[model samples]
Target: MKKSLITSLAAVLLLSATAATAQQKSMGGMQDMPMGKPATGQSVHMARGKVTKVDAGANLVTLAHEPVKSLNWPAMTMGFQVKDKMLLDKLTVGRMVDFEFAQAGKGYAITGVK
Candidate 1:
C-alpha cells in the first residue's frame, strides 16, 4: 500500500509539473511586445458604431462602438476628440464614421474622416 501511495503521489506531481510548464509557455506568448515607445505616425481606423454623445464644450465625442478595423479597442462606447472641430460639423449623433486619427498631447484627435 505504501508503494502504491508513493506511485500515485509521484504521478500527481508529474502531471502538475507538466501543467505548470504549459501554462508558463502560454503566458510567455502573451507578453507585451517592447517597441520602446508607442508607434508614431499611427492612424487609428475607428470601429463601426454610432456616436452616443457629443460634448463640443469638452472637445470630446463619445461613441457607442465596436472594434475599429484600423484600431484596437475593447469597448463599445468611447470618447475621443475630433482631430479638428471641423470634423464635428460632418458628424452627427447616430451616424457612423470610418475615422482615422492618432493620439496627440491630449486624447485622440482626428487625422481623417471618411
Candidate 2:
C-alpha cells in the first residue's frame, strides 16, 4: 500500500508539471508578443518634442518631434492621440516636452507628456 501511494503521488506531480509547461506554451511561452509590436518586457520609448498644436476637443496633439532611437522613427511633424486628455491640459503650441509613447492600432498614442 505504501509503494502504491508513493507511485501515484509521483505520477501526479509529473502530470502537473507537464500541464503547466503546456499551458505556458499555449499562451505564447510566458510572454505575449502582439503582432507588429515591439518585443515584450522592453521599456517604453521616450522622446523629446515641441508641441505644434493642440486640439482638446478632438483629443489630439501635433508635435514636431526628435528622432526616437528605440522605435527607429525620424524627426517629423505628426499628430498623436492622447491616452488621457488630462495629459494635454498643460500642452500648448511651441512648448518643449519630454514624453513617452507607444504604437497603438494604426497610430501613435501618447502615454505621457511633460
Candidate 3:
C-alpha cells in the first residue's frame, strides 16, 4: 500500500511539473517564443509602439509607448530586432507610427512601418 501511494504521488508531481512548464511556455520565460494569432486560434495582428532607441549595427531598436498584443507586453519598454535596414531610417524616436513585424523564430523583425 505504501508503494502504491508513493507511485501515485510521483505521478501527480510529474503532471504538475508538466502543467507548470506549459503555462510558462505561453507566458514569458527566458527567450520565450513569439506569440502568433494562428497559434492562439485567432487572427493576430502587428503591435505598434513608439521608437525609443535604435541601433543600426545590431539591427535592433528599443520601443516604449504602448501595449503589444502580439508579444503580450503592456505599455512598457521593449526591444525588437529589425528585419530590414530600410526600417532604420523610418524610425523616429518619440513619434507615434503604425508598424508591423514578423517573428523570426526566436526574436522579431519589423517588416512594415507607415
Candidate 4:
C-alpha cells in the first residue's frame, strides 16, 4: 500500500509540474517579466485614433483608437500614460493622431505621436 501511495503522489507531482509549465508558456514567458515597469526592448505597438481627452496634469491621454494588429486588440477607447508630460502637449481633444506605444507595467505608455 505504501508503494502504491508513493506512485500516486509522484503522478500528482508530475501533473502539477506539467500544468505550471504550460501556463507559463501560454503567457509567453511573462511570468518572469516585472510589473509596474516596462520590459527592456519591448516591442512597440502602433495605432491610429482620435483624441478624446488630454489630461496634462495626470500625463494621460484618452483615445478612441483603431484596431491594434500588433497586440491583436480590437478598436476601443482607452487612456494611455505618456512617456513624458510633453507628449500631452501634442494631444488635443477631437484631434486625429498616429501614435506609437509600448507596454508599461500593467498598462501602456505612449512613446510618440503625430
Candidate 5:
C-alpha cells in the first residue's frame, strides 16, 4: 500500500511539472510574436498633440499626444514615421496639430495631419 501511494504521488507531481512547463512554453510563444500591429488598410486613429521634436532627416516626427481612444493608448510622447518627408515640414516643436496614424509595423506611421 505504501509503495502504491508513493507512486501515485509521484505521478501527480510529474503531471504538475508537465503542466507548468507547457504553460511556460505558451507564454514564451506569445512574447515571440508582435500583437499590436494594425492590419493593412486599418482605420487611422486621430489624435492631437504638440510636436515635441521633428527629425526630417530620418522622416520621423516626435509628438506628445493626448490619449488615443481608438487604439486604447494613453497620453505619451513617442516618435512616428511619415512616408513622405514633406509631411515633417508641417510640424514644428511645441506646435499643436491633429494627426491621423495607423500601426505600420512595430511603430506607427502618420497617414494624415491637419
Candidate 6:
C-alpha cells in the first residue's frame, strides 16, 4: 500500500510540473525570450499611452503606455519602431494615442496609430 501511495504521489507531482511549464509557455515566457516577441499566432496587441518622445530620424516613438493585456505587460514606457517614418508625423510629445503594434525582429513595431 505504501509503495502504491508513493507512485500515485509521484504521478501527481509530475503532472503538476508539466502543467506549470505549459502555463509559463502560454504566458509567453517573456523573461526567456526578448520582450515583445509573442508566441505564434499572437501577432498584434493594442495599447493606449501618451507619446513621450518621437525620434523621426530613426522612426522610433517612445510612449508611456497603459497595461498591454494581450502581452501580459504592466504599464510601462518603451520605444517602438514605426512601420513607416510617415507615422511619426501623427505622433507628438505629450499627446495620447491609441496604437496597434506587433513584434518585429528584436523589438516592437507600431503598425497604426489614432
Clash statistics: count for each candidate: 3, 0, 0, 0, 0, 0
Candidate 4 C-alpha lDDT tens digits along 5-110: 6555545434543553454457562423222233567777788999986666557777889977665555777777789777787899999999988767656679
**Deviation of model 3 at 24, angstroms:** 7.6
The most accurate candidate by lDDT is 6
Report lDDT (CA) for all predictions: 0.55, 0.66, 0.60, 0.69, 0.67, 0.71
Better of 4 and 5 by lDDT: 4
Extract clashing residue pairs from model 3: none
TM-score per candidate, in order?
A: 0.53, 0.61, 0.56, 0.65, 0.63, 0.64
Candidate 2 accuracy as TM-score: 0.61
Q: Cα RMSDs of all predictions? A: 19.0, 20.4, 15.5, 16.5, 19.4, 17.4
lDDT of 5 by residue, 9-95 (tens): 545434543553355456453322222344464666788999976666556777889977665555776777786677787888999
Per-residue lDDT of model 1, residues 1-114, tens digit only: 967865555454345435433544564443322212325644444445677666664455666666543333344454566667877876678788766655555345555567
Predict model 4's lDDT versus the native. Answer: 0.69
Q: How good is model 5 by TM-score?
A: 0.63
lDDT, candidate 4, residue 73?
56
| Model 6, global lDDT | 0.71
Candidate 2 lDDT, tens digit per residue, 1-114? 967865555454345435533544564524423223334333466789999877676667777889766654557666776888889876788899988776555456777777
Residue lDDT tens for model 3, 1-108: 967865555454345434434543677553424444443243334666888766675676666646665545456555666777988888867867677765554444
Off by over 4 Å in 6: 1-42
Which has the better lDDT: candidate 5, or candidate 6? 6
Candidates 4 and 5, the one with greater TM-score: 4
Off by over 4 Å in 4: 1-39
